[model samples]
Target: MHKINVHLLGHMSQCETQESSHDSKSKDFRQSDSYSVNETNHTKAPISSTGGTNNKTVPQTSEQETEKRIIRRSPWIDTSSSESNSIHHVVPIKTSDTCPKENTEESIIADLPLPDLPPEPPTELSDSFKELPPINYGQSNSSLGGIGDCNAYNAINSKKRSLEDNETEIKVSRDTWNTKNMRSLEPPRSKKRIHLIAAVKAVKSIKPIRTTLRYDEAITYNKDIKEKEKYIEAYHKEVNQLLKMKTWDTDKYYDRKEIDPKRVINSMFIFNRKRDGTHKARFVARGDIQHPDTYDSGMQSNTVHHYALMTSLSLALDNNYYITQLDISSAYLYADIKEELYIRPPPHLGMNDKLIRLKKSLYGLKQSGANWYETIKSYLIKQCGMEEVRGWSCVFKNSQVTICLFVDDMVLFSKNLNSNKRIIDKLKMQYDTKIINLGESDEEIQYDILGLEIKYQRGKYMKLGMENSLTEKIPKLNVPLNPKGRKLSAPGQPGLYIDQQELELEEDDYKMKVHEMQKLIGLASYVGYKFRFDLLYYINTLAQHILFPSKQVLDMTYELIQFIWNTRDKQLIWHKSKPVKPTNKLVVISDASYGNQPYYKSQIGNIYLLNGKVIGGKSTKASLTCTSTTEAEIHAISESVPLLNNLSYLIQELDKKPITKGLLTDSKSTISIIISNNEEKFRNRFFGTKAMRLRDEVSGNHLHVCYIETKKNIADVMTKPLPIKTFKLLTNKWIH
Candidate 1:
């Protein structure tokens, strides 16, 4: 038995010496051999069972049994033998009896017979392997198992390769293998990690708060000392202005029983920074809390429509009319309020517990705008001898001049500067009016009204833009690194389409994100609706996702905002291409993109032009789904009729002549459906009613439906995402 144990030990020692010699030849050989062993754990290989060179497949031992065999070996034994052996006899050593006092690899190797040494190694092999660091087998318990455990073998090989110059070779192999089985090998990522990565990559910089501050926030905010003082001073100025205007009856204190506390409502100061670097504090009542029964709902004030403003500007530019802008100071204060209302003064005003009765229409009252509108309407029509246009109540005109009023801001168009001055003098006499722009001649007119910058070159062109609108709202963000580790220098340009997906966010976080997204979209919507028609479609598309915005939606919105900020200088210019006559026709270009929205709803786009100048347009989602492109086109035409009718009425009222209205569409089928008189031909279609109404308009000569090629339709930009070239062509070249 002793001789048999010695023989087995000698065999193991010989195998270990041969493996050590082979490993010393090349580091590449060690890596390849370790990989082969790992592969052979689950596959057939051409390794002999006796650890000799052989080309035969052997049945491998189970990994569990192999691990047990390795654990049972002596600590100093070489467990990295490439061959598997089964023990027939047991020779257990007791610590107190057969075991040596010192258990070490040198002692074990000395007990066994010495095997014949190999020939001297080559100089290249000696130099390459000599400097290779030895593996630290004592670092972990699992390392004792050595090559018996394929995982341990690979780990050790990885450690050794990391210390060597062949790291690139090992990395290449690992990357290749990982690429083939990446999905299986990758561990599941936590939701937090995913969100963190997305947030880090999405925004380049934080957007600064540019919104108005509430009264409390304004007073308490001390970040900027100058700004804080300005806010306080502005508040004082607002209080003084209200007192001078006698907005409320401060002389008499109203008892709580006299008026319902709810009806009395609350008031606060809204602080804002104006464009010219002046701080403005507006004292507004809490009109939102006012009961509906407190005021007449039917008396709601109407502001001038965008279409009317554009039409008037187009007319003024075409006819070389003198243009000027007027700003009414405390215009709402001049109007009386029929309803008895009360409001609390700001805390700092020292009117503790005393409620002031409202005598005039104060800003923030529900009916303030309507009351102011009526006052101005009465003064312009009865006092100034100007007649209100038939359709637009905010627009007043006479034989010599036309006036467009939006809230407190007003635009006057006159045949001469004297006529404009006459109206301005009358306005200044009745109410405090500031002339924002007084055009001295017909050659040039520049002014800003309702945030729109208007530049009119008489008989040449009228350009309308909302400059600094986006730049002032959106802030610079940090650009994220791409996969290649490079920063993107150019501004992001998003398409008109949004692909929404379910986002991974907690309910509260999601709601907060959604609120932020809505505010951003609101800013975009204002610019898109006012003059930047090129962004209308994109804004509409993004607005649809506000209910369930995700990281992708936020990122895309930032991109859209960035694009708008970069291209804010571009304006909507109306070139004078033809003479303006009383009989000139109102042209309408309509388009639709079918099944583009979620739930198969279509997109409707329309452009209203008068004498080759754009007056107004709309880009919105269809209310109902349309099954076909022709149906979508018909839907767009039907939807645009109301606006078109209003525009035509305003133009005819201005010109004092019956004007012809024409509808241009890219779809011949839609035109055919509108012009078709056969009732049975469209009986199967559900749009028969709309088609018949349109046909009546056509037959009655109120509208002329004509076919325009798709490429020539400027409204195409409003329906779908177009190539940048086509978008520029339609918006910059064709529209102008």
Candidate 2:
């Protein structure tokens, strides 16, 4: 006879039943065993004999009895008590007598919550039972209360069906259930629960979305992150640069106990993308902290490299020199800070909590730019044998090269190529420069300076235009005015009401609205100056009402901006040619609209031309009122002579020789008074005095005034509003 041995864990309790050999008045042997355990628990099934009585009895075929059983474990009972944690005895499942049961009770344990077991049997299991199948009673969902008709039972019943199909049926024990097949046995109501399987599959099959974040503060669901190392590298680079310049010291402990938190300047990273798709990281010192004078008392940054005198430089060195541009990097970081300043160490730099004592000037400090300018200017004068031009401190000249800087961007002009190289090398030795137009010939160099494109075209014309990148962001218009090709209609009102300042929105909305209006007008004004001269009068007329802008003013501004966008592709030609009339002089045109504004003030329009090319112009409201067109024109001339007289000085400045300039206007009376010292003709007291200064500027300087036909006066475009045909006729030749 063969005896089968079984092992059970201490945490388990079992009541086993076995059949006696005689059924033959077959008797059942029953034993109840209980044990307590602290660790994981296990259980084993009733063993049958291999002798004649070892016959694998079929459960349903037996007339004696068939009992179906199941085990229910309560997972949420008090774990602190061993009695509560112990496994309860198996409970017989109540089913109809007609229901079939398994001869072996293996299916009963299929849904029990069993602890995990190792692949290799433990020491508690004897080698005698090595080939036996593992008694794995895995945990199933408790949602199926007592596992009456759930998927676990359905799977078990399916196994029984497969076994019953064979002639000599052998029960197959499977520990797992196929959810899809298990759900097939369910009624329609249970169908909704099966959607969980499909939902899981759907989720796993689909991929996550990738998003580009602004500053990492607003992303909801993103699968990718930007390269974090780039930001870290930028921060480290800045910190190292500052350290090398002795901008701070953390080696010795400073007294931070008495330091006021408000006195410490906060610093942050300003990330920028350049035109070439590279990154720029600047550490800015927040001077807005502390007082208005803090970090702002030293030097004035408003004295940035002079740009107004550029035309003089252009006229002096147009044909004689190679136009080159370069930018000095870290220009502000080179100078020393006058006052002892403390800054909170930027977190990205990975510095400790200790405050940083700044020794050198840093970016974002109000006076840093001015300090750097002084340092560079001193270096140029002392080391490079360069003379500083008092008119424009940014302009520096050596024996052969002339350099003009606006902030950090330096434009160099040298007649000799070797002289340029020498000057550039000298600058490079003293400062790090990004050579934008390095040894390139002026004819091939199209450099952008101060939003203006200074380019030599085809080795013939020195063209000054606008930077395309600067204006591309403005709103584009399909039509100059209304989209339907109709002229813009006014908003029922003229100007803003005087007391309208009292009307306000929420603080943020008001600021945003104002900024929107300002940005629209500001950029539109620039775009007009670049190529859209038609927008000049409108923008000028609209800008006056920006402070208390009404809906009407905004409506007009939008119309003008739309017009500018419509003609965005146009540009006035800036070229120098021997005058068609043999006059190596300027052509000045001044016009005015008398008492045209809502305040009854006159508008002055002035245009300056050199060698027949429009160099500069203005369309502005006159500071004082004018009674007549003559007075307005005369005042406009007075306002304009300062700028034109400066041009005369520029001409004489070029070669130390007298150069003549011409002024053209339709106001013959105003022109007559300006060219003469005749006080009798000056009707207005204000304009009379202005005319005397105008006469002195015309004669004292070599500027000449002449009268041109109104149709021929291009400056008429600046004076007042005109029809499209008249505007085109007057401005088409000079602009666009």
Candidate 3:
């Protein structure tokens, strides 16, 4: 047993460490000789016999038993030899580095290069040798590789040189016999015979079911559904009129290319961001007929051009009244087509399909705009009994309420005297319109009003927001890394470049960092909280660790989500209410991330409040160009005007009025721009024009834009990430 253990261990160690020995080889030789002696174990079943022992000892057998007894008593010694049966101990292999050549050969042969065996078969058959009946077979196991070898290996490794030489002789003889057999069995082909066979098969085939037409007789079909018939006839007559006039082509055809049918439709509805707080739908044609520079022809001349028009319409309506917006179901379908147009039907429709003669205005046609405008005008003026307002084609009125129209979009105000049902009934009778009632579903529709995201909120009809969306609907305005012309150097080394090109890559990186910081601080400020400067830096570091590559945007979004989750339990509330005074008015505090280039645009930070409720706020970059602090403030003021106006309308819409409105700018010159209104002009025409417009609008509504001392304004939180003391002060005023 000790020898066996040493042998197994030595086998494994020899393979691993290359140890060799002579005694191990001798032992292997002895084991192999034992395998040859066991032919019965390979070829036959075992033979069994029973015997009983004597009272004192085991019973002795006859000649066969005596020989077995001698074999058992002296297993290693040859029983045929006359030598005495002396037991010789089996010695263990030498544990030395240098092994004898004989031992090495025996050891290697014992560790045979055999392929791995499949799972073990039934083991009931004994491995020991015994006697059994013999049967003769041609494919003997010993003649082959060994017992249990797969036949597939013989086929793969066969080396029969004579088989390749007879290949051509076999093919010629086989082909000649096959040709003779085919000629004897088959008939010759003929054109007449083939045609006769095909005709018989065709006659025996099953026929498809025939379909009956629903409108074989137009007069009878019309009688069956009178209203539908009337509509069809009216449409046909309208189409005939359009056929007599002149129009452009509007039909689309695809040969074999893939197309997104919905994308083509949606693109038409999401063109520009407008100010009107209404359900708006915009469209732009393919303009494939024009050059790239001439694509302006695709613009719809009749759609509401700006948000100011929408706001003005809202302002003209009464306070006690509710404004309801109605969208025309297929608005273009109702417009009378006063032009002749032809459209080749779609590819799959049919080659011989007749073109659809235009009955109503459709997209992509030149005459469609004028026809739609004229149709809407006639309907509102003649059919609806609306009084057309002078100098405004879209604005219309009856004695009870005013209807403001921008092409197909109309806002109907229900005056204090008239009930809501009356206005709805009147509009329904004239045209097909869908009323978008607030709070219908949880899904939100986002649109930009003063560049703030307005979503439908409960208690009030809508709420204004300043948070960036997890996803943007329009492709993000590809914010350039650095747009200004300033030369930026790498980090750690001021004048060095990241690579040989000296791309100013580090400055681009810094610009992004500053932008991210600005956004974070903006959120804190907008919500009336002051983030710790170190906390901001720590957050930035955490951001770095999480986002070493292009994942920074995603990391920032996650951190923001975390921030929102952590702070969700509380909201900003004033600890104490100050008395109503001229100096204690709501103020907009301003700051900027300056001395940084090439993103040298000014940052606009603002917060507006009424009755201590922070009604509207924002922290963002100014879109307009500016060279100085005064210009920056003027730009910020222009950027903030629409928000302030929206807030005022919201207050009025909700019926809350405040005593005074003020704009807080640190720069006195910006205050001068506000105070002068139009009297003083600046070098940059952008500020002067926008400032005058803001002044005129504010003054017309009796609101004021004043510059307070910087310490008093709560909007300072927007400029940059602040230290603990200043952050706390700003947050304390806006948030309790």
Best model per lDDT: 1
Q: Which residue pairs clash within candidate 1? A: 204-477, 204-478, 205-477, 205-478
Residues forming the 10-long window of minimal summed lDDT in candidate 2: 23-32
Models 1 onward score TM values of: 0.68, 0.62, 0.37
Clashing pairs in 2: 23-26
lDDT of 1 by residue, 1-736 (tens): 0011111001112122122211111122222222122213324332221121111123354675344333221112112221232111111111222223343212212111111222322221123222333333322111100111122223333233232322222122323323543433344333221232133124332233346789778878557888899999998888888889888787778666666776776888888888667899998888878988788888878898888988888777666777888899888999999997788877786775778888889888889999999888989988899998886879998998888998998988877889989998998888989988887755666677788877877778777877665455555222111323322211222121232222455444555565666677777777877887767877776665565455555665665665665567778877665533334457777887654454446678997777666677788878886655556777888888888888877877776654556676655455545544456545345667767776665555456555543444678667765444344546665223
lDDT of 3 by residue, 1-736 (tens): 0011111001111111001111111111112211111112322311101000000012223585344323211011111211121111111112221323243312221211111222322222232311211212222121000111122211332222233432321222323323533423334232111111122122221222111122223323446575445444543443443333322233543332243222222102122222342222222233234223322244344543233333332232213244555566545555655433334432233543344333555555455565676677777667677765544456566655556565566656544424434656766786666675412333543433323444432222333333443123111322221223222110010111111111112333434433443444344332332212112322322222221112232233333333333333332232122332222223233433221111234445666554343433455545554454445555666666666655454333322333334444444444444445344354545645766775665555544433332333355445433323333444543332
Best-to-worst ranking by lDDT: 1, 2, 3
Q: By descending TM-score, how would the candidates be arranged?
A: 1, 2, 3
Candidate 3: misplaced stretches above 4 Å? 1-320, 323-325, 337-340, 346-348, 352-354, 364-374, 381-411, 415-420, 438-599, 605-628, 638-662, 672-705, 708-736
Error of 3 at 60 (Å): 99
Candidate 2, superposed: residue stretches over 4 Å from native: 1-233, 250-257, 260-263, 289-298, 302-313, 316-320, 349-353, 470-472, 475-511, 528-534, 579-584, 654-657, 675-678
How far residue 7's Cα lies from its native spot in candidate 3, in Å, is: 78
The segments of candidate 1 whose C-alpha lies over 4 angstroms from its true place after superposition are 1-210, 255-259, 476-501, 580-583, 683-685, 734-736
